[model samples]
Target chain A: MKDDLTDRILVVLSSVLMLTAVYMIFFYAPTERVMGIVQKIFYFHLPLAFMAFLSYFVAFVSGVLYLVKKDIKWDIIGSASVEIGVVFTTLVLITGSLWARPIWNTWWTWDPRLTSSLILWLIYVAYIILRMSVEQAERRATFCAVMAIVGFIDVPIVFLSARLWRTIHPVVIKSKSIDMEPAMISVLAISMAAFLLFWITLIRIRSRVDFMELRIRNLEKIKRGGME
Target chain B: MKNLTYLAAAYGIVWAGLFSYLWYILSKQNVLVGRIKALEGDD
Candidate 1:
């Protein structure tokens, strides 16, 4: 269908960008003198974290729109974003742990950034579980909208945790400077763009599936009524 | 140690995680479409 043309193009663009970013990450970006090769994980870890944050932001905006417009489509977008966000958050935690194991010599730590990120993951995960438990469509949508907006409170806390507290996590962006080489910065920018476009493609696929499911449910209900 | 193992694991997990989620979503989509077609055929 014509509706899917954008989705098809975005999928290809994102995949190509992702491959380019990966090649640059390995070959082009200079290795950190102190951390050595393990430092390469930072290229991926930061982008995954960025995408997770973007997902929650989209969810928050969709939640607000759903409340204002009283539309089911907004609910669909919010929940889809949360679902993708949770997967992204899970990866963030795993990748962080991997990086931490080698550098800090510990797999897990209760630092402010780590703790807040875990809490953020749990919040949206609970949001997904909430959707699954409720049967009444309207009530479920309302709960999802409210929860998405409220859960977004943790995102800023997660972002500022390193700065706001005495955390072991590295603060990449300080008051006036970023501490990476020019090449590293370019690779990171490309990686972020790649992931953002990929996230959009994912949203399109998820929202289409949800709309189809909703239509099927409505049709089934009507068919049952007709039979009765 | 230079931590090559950790590096590989980290990148591997990222790719695996993303691909796994994509697979799950696509599978769910396929199943739903099948149901819709079945319903339409019956009517």
Candidate 2:
């Protein structure tokens, strides 16, 4: 009953948080002068990138849990994090392209950030494909655990590769040294909050769906006399 | 012309892409929920 209630609360909270985010982005946030309307992409792009990073970090932690405890829940969490990470990363890529068209005068580029992100995306895609290839659950989970651990090594690399290479992606949005207006900073903070809420809600919903599917599969196997 | 066109393109792409993703997630959830229902019936 407690778990059911938690799920319900999460469902409601996610809806409300998303609605609020939409409202804040469209109404409260001031249009950027330099990027103009295109600047709105920053609100979503930065948040998606941050959440993608968080998702991979979650995968890394859960990967450790899987290795230590050998708990299937840990494996499930790791897999779910990877899946969500991929989705957000894809969004980041798309939004980056939109931002790039205006700022860079190109749809795509071979810049360090863009290149590294594409590499990270491919690596996780391979991990998912690897998960699907194996027949046995235990073997698949074990293999994926290893892959998840290895995959996380690339997260920091992707994040810093751009900075290290001195790529054109802005180093900081608003800084005390070269500060944006106070109002801009406040708006950015609110946007970040909204995005974080969005990420947590998405992960919770996906995790529940993952759990339910696993339960269904188990029941199916039992009904078939452990055939699968 | 170039600056104005780029701004319009950026907004268009952002909204269109997000809408597509939102649709994708909804359709996927719908499919998964159907699977859940079928499994419940089977048991």
Candidate 3:
């Protein structure tokens, strides 16, 4: 009962904040002098990237914990995190492409940041596929835990690719400070907060499903031939 | 208003993808609920 209330609160809060973020993105933030309307993509693009990285980080931690503790719950966390992480990364890639068409004069580019991010997406996708192929529960969980940890190696590379290489991707955050005005900064902060809540809500939903799946599998084992 | 098509497309796809994923999760939940009910009925 308590958990359901918390989930409802999170769902409502996330929806409200997301609507606010949308309003602020389209109305509150000032248009860039050069990029014009297309610069609005930055509002969501940045947050999507942040969430992707955060999701994978959670998956990585879950992997480590699962390996250390051999807990199915930790494996479930890693699996759920990776699934959402892929969704966010897909949005990141597509939105980045959309923004690049007008800004960079191309739909896609082989730049360092773009390439590394694509690699990161592909790795997680393979993780999901590989997990599906393994039949045994413990073996599947162990395989996923290992892949989640190893695949996370691409995350840091994606993060630093823009800074390390000469790329068209704009580095919004420098070591000292941000490059935008106060209005834009506020919008970004709101969007980030909204996305954080969005991530939490989705993660909870996915975790519940994961738990349900485990229950169903146990019930199936009983249905096969075992005593009730 | 420049590049408005691109802007709209970007936001549109993001929302569509998110809502679709949410719908998928809920549908999966429904399927599991049915399966659980059926299994419990058998026992």
Categorize the docking of model 1: high
The sequence of per-residue lDDT tens digits that candidate 1 reaches over residues A23-127 is 999899999998888988888889889889998999999989998998999999998999999999999999999999989999999999999999999999999
Q: DockQ for each of the predicted structures, in order? A: 0.80, 0.33, 0.81
Itemize residue pairs with steric clashes in candidate 2. Answer: none
How far in Å is the alpha carbon of A109 misplaced in model 3?
A: 0.7
B30 Cα displacement, candidate 1 (Å): 1.9
Query: Candidate 2: which stretches are off by over 4 Å?
Result: A1-33, A173-179, A226-228, B1-43
Better of 1 and 3 by lDDT: 3
Q: Provide the overall lDDT of each model, using Cα atoms, as 2-decimal numbers.
A: 0.91, 0.74, 0.92
- In candidate 3, what are the lDDT values of residues A176-199, reduced to their tens digit? 999999999999999999889989
lDDT of 2 at A117: 90
Model 3 residue pairs with clashes: none
lDDT tens digits by residue: candidate 2, A60-171: 8988889899899988888888887888788788878878887788889998889889888898889889988998988988999898899888888877775588787765
Candidate 2, DockQ score (0 to 1): 0.33
Q: How large an RMSD does model 1 have?
A: 1.5
Evaluate candidate 3 by giving its C-alpha RMSD to the native, one decimal: 1.5
Query: By the TM-score metric, which is better: model 2 or model 3?
Result: 3
